[model samples]
Target: MSKAHELLKKYWGYDSFRYPQEEIIASVLDGKDTLALLPTGGGKSLCFQIPALVNEGICLVISPLVALMKDQVDNLMKRDIKAIALTGGIHADEVITLLDNCVYGNYKFLYVSPERLQQDWVLEKIKNLPLNLIAIDEAHCISQWGHDFRPSYTKINLLKPLFPNVPMIALTASATLDVKKDIIKQLEMQQPKLFQISFARENIGYFVYETEDKGYKIEQILKKNPEPSIIYVRNRKMCHDLSFQLSQLGFQTTFYHGGLPKREKEKNMHLWMSEKAQVIVATNAFGMGIDKPNVRTVIHVQLPENLENYYQESGRAGRNGEKSFAVLLHHPSDTVSAQSQFIHSLPDKEFLKTVYNKLCNYFQIAYGEGIDEQFSFNLNHFCSQYQFPVIKTYNSLTFLDRQGIITFSQEYSEKIVLQFLLESKEVIRYISLNPQDEEVILAVLRNYSGIYDMPTAINLSLISRKSNQPEAVIEATLLRLKEKGIIEYTAKNNDSSITFNEVREDERTINRVSKYLEAQNELKQNKLQAVLDYVTDKAHCKNSLILNYFGERGTADCGNCSYCISKKVTKSNSEKDSNVLLKLIKEKPLSSRELQQITKISEEQLIFALQELLDNDFIKVLPNNKYTIN
Candidate 1:
């Protein structure tokens, strides 16, 4: 067997690669730049991972989300693979050490954010590493037309010049034709090969329902389906509110959003994954690295701003190819609300300038000062002090960051560090004195090394699990140990960070990207219009509409979609009842009840046929609640 196949079997226990995976891997192994457009749950990671194992040097993976990086790294470690992720909020010394490990320690994979590439030290260190391949996950972000555009992704071209001979692979689950072309152009790939698996997911049944009472409708759907489900909402508050409502409706449910602490988020996610919770109410932040295969339904309470976002989120269902549902509940006011909230509320150039000036002032950086300085930012406090809307303020900050004025990273989790202060004999003596703290302390010591010399990052949850103790007890014991001066413990903090990229600039300099920003705004508006069009359209097949929007054409109508099924039922009823109505009307004008009695049709069916016939001018309704031929 080939080395790639052997590694796949030994590590992932897979006997064969999925469709297009082996081909993409072969292309990369031949030292060719490649782009793989796999759908969600199509096993995109294995394409890069298997090749990295087969090759001799380390593979550099550029990812966008810190959570996704951490998840992949953890999974790789569990499989006994040496992988490290350099995410935001890590200490600079740790980063240097990680880079050194990649160069000398024979690490197989190094995952870093695109923003990290902007650092001179990082670039210099990467240039020295024995790099074999450069893999870009979520590659669509490199393009301005993508739903999640990050300006930092454009800086990735710098790596091409640094490692000219190394092959590169870019992967994304969702991208339009325009975004696909732009990704290749921006990355400057050398005659890259393109591999795309069809975006159509045949197993998922698409559905849309127009209703006023969403809560009741949701309950009805859940009761009828009664399977593991995801309910996606727009905001954090709605996550909690909908979760509470579901629980009240007799559902074992949990909620997740980006604002929650890392530990809480993990706990809720574990509950859902383990099937302890029947439903999860979440925002878009919930499902990046989640690999649950039996997700029976995905319900969208509000319309997403674009089809890419919608497709990616809804695609989470039916990974096992079992029958599943991707349902959208649309209220009459949903479109207007979505447009006002997502488009009109975007930060204008003047507003962005005001935010930039305020941020500089808040950080106490004089104009033309404070370049490359990092600070722990409290966005809530800043917004409260300045009386700025939190969402709009966040959008403005993101704009400034994308314009290359600053680097704003909101998703950062604090790292916990622990150091043993007591000598070995002294530690034994203290442990004897405090028997209650013995289990956790011993677990920490057994799991981690070099704690006597310097603080090491510790996973308290892991310690709790191994020690067979509750997390709260383990935390209290650590605090007691700290009080006794036996060890030093630093609890994790979840906060955001900001780094000034360029020296403080005036309004004119801040507005440099105004034209580009306007273009982005227009794109967002157009995308929003597309979403509205999908929800309001009732004539076409839902699957066909979605496929066409993604640049696929001539897709057959999915016979099982809500629209198709409704059309079939309507046609059946009209054909059966219209014949009777036409025959009765031809004999004589008659009352509705008389026609129903003569045709032996139910009242509802008779009325429906009469309406259909009247619509076609084959019959007409008279003044006294009677029917006649037109």
Candidate 2:
């Protein structure tokens, strides 16, 4: 028994390893970059978590879900292990402190969001740490062909050189052949060995139903199988609406979406875990980081934009090796709505540029002005700033953020602000060369709390009003201090999460660069659709279709899907028996006409055919001496 197996037994309470677990750990222990593509519910966390404990240094796990981070960390802590998750919810000072602790605190696992990887502090800290391994959960996000593609994920390769000697592991439950290659390329995996398990959920009963009244249909499903369920809708409002409906029907239901405040989101998630709300009615955004094993059913009241999403959301059910239902309640209009969303969301090149320009101009930003600055951005303020419609412009800005041109994290944009890192006496010496900072230094010190050690929360408007200085002068003074290495400032604005350097480039060059970015997005979306084609396909066996998509051969249809089950039904029925059953039923009033058909054939043969039809329930015999098709 190795150290990993020992921890698995002692902490996780598992006496033995699952299939391929020990092998995957051994490969990592040997210091190899490994990609583990296991099916959902295959215990992927154990493969990475156990190795991190047995290894020499800390394991850095990159994931997008805050709920998932908290859950995993909490579970680990319960077992007397040290784990922590760093997300955007905490203050910058808190984050720095957490990272510092990870460095010197002897923690085994440190979970971080992808967004954190973009920050200078995060990147700088990782460089100095003796990292044991890097684990990228949902590695498919790095692939353009995946359902969830994050542009920041493309920059993941930047971490490679920082930890050249450290081995990395990329784990995802779902990925097509194209996605696998993309993940490797995006991460620049070192010719790594890939362990891809077949994407098959034999215990999940797959059912796709088309209905006219979605709410009523959902009510019907809940009435019968009222176990722990997830009701998926397309938007935030719909999640609330259906959750209310289900609650009215006496089911404990709660909803989740991005629009909710982070606190409320976590609260609702807590309610879900405690079974206070037995069902979670939410949008596709709900379950990415969720790992509830006993989800008895997943009902999609509305259809997802593509099959990749549907497959992932459905796979969340029956994680405990128990039977579960994945039901899709789709209508003709749903298909139309999904298609329309895909088409409408395909922003054009000109639109992206115009929106990008409007956003930059609204912030009064020039070609390259904001570098390493964080700001509070309100989307509505920008639209009001330029008289542009908020919705479309907001969408465009997100696309730009997705394209890595900007970062728009705030719901509202506040003015630029900062404070002195040094006191007035200390500031005097610093400003001796310029002799122009005395007034501004006093103004910043008189206001803005806690500026000496940690960066104070700054709203530029307050500083300007108190200092009686123009906004430009205040902005300029802060920039000078930042340049002089005296203090740092973050500009909070609404729109793209982009940080532009003060380096000015010709306007034409910027436009040309924007065009290339748009071109990349267009190509990426097409590749994503190619993966969707594999998801909704009804012609082939699920296993064989997935295998073939990934360029695998010697694959056959697994007798486990809806199609395979239907085929088994057809095969069990003889063609001649099907014909005889149909003819006998139409002839009517044939009392046990079993022998009559028998007289037409040999008695033994006729009896056998009738029994086959009866066994499959293709025909029904009435008490009134009449046989009919069932």
The candidate that wins on TM-score is 1
Q: Candidate 2: worst 10 consecutive residues by lDDT?
A: 495-504
TM-score of each: 0.81, 0.67
Task: Provide the lowest-lDDT 10-residue window in model 1.
Answer: 460-469
After superposing candidate 2, which stretches have Cα over 4 Å from the reference? 9-13, 62-103, 107-125, 149-155, 158-162, 361-367, 375-394, 407-630
| TM-score (C-alpha) between model 2 and the true structure | 0.67
Candidate 1: regions farther than 4 A off: 89-97, 368-376, 401-407, 412-495, 499-503, 506-509, 571-630
* Residue range 1-630, candidate 1, lDDT tens digits: 288888889998989988999999999999999999999888999999998888899999999775688678777876768788875545577678779878777689999988789788889999999999999999998999987787789999999998999999999998989999999999999999999988889999998876555787688778878888999999889999999998998999999987787668879999999999989999988887787999999999999989888998999999988999999998657888998788877988888878888999999999888876778788999999999998789888877766556767666455578999989899989889878888888889887889999999886545643454655577778888899898999966757778776678777666666776777788889999999999888789999999998889999999877777666556687787898778877888887657756877753355456657877998876666467888
Per-residue CA lDDT of candidate 2, range 138-184, in tens?
89878666766766687778889999988889998778788888998
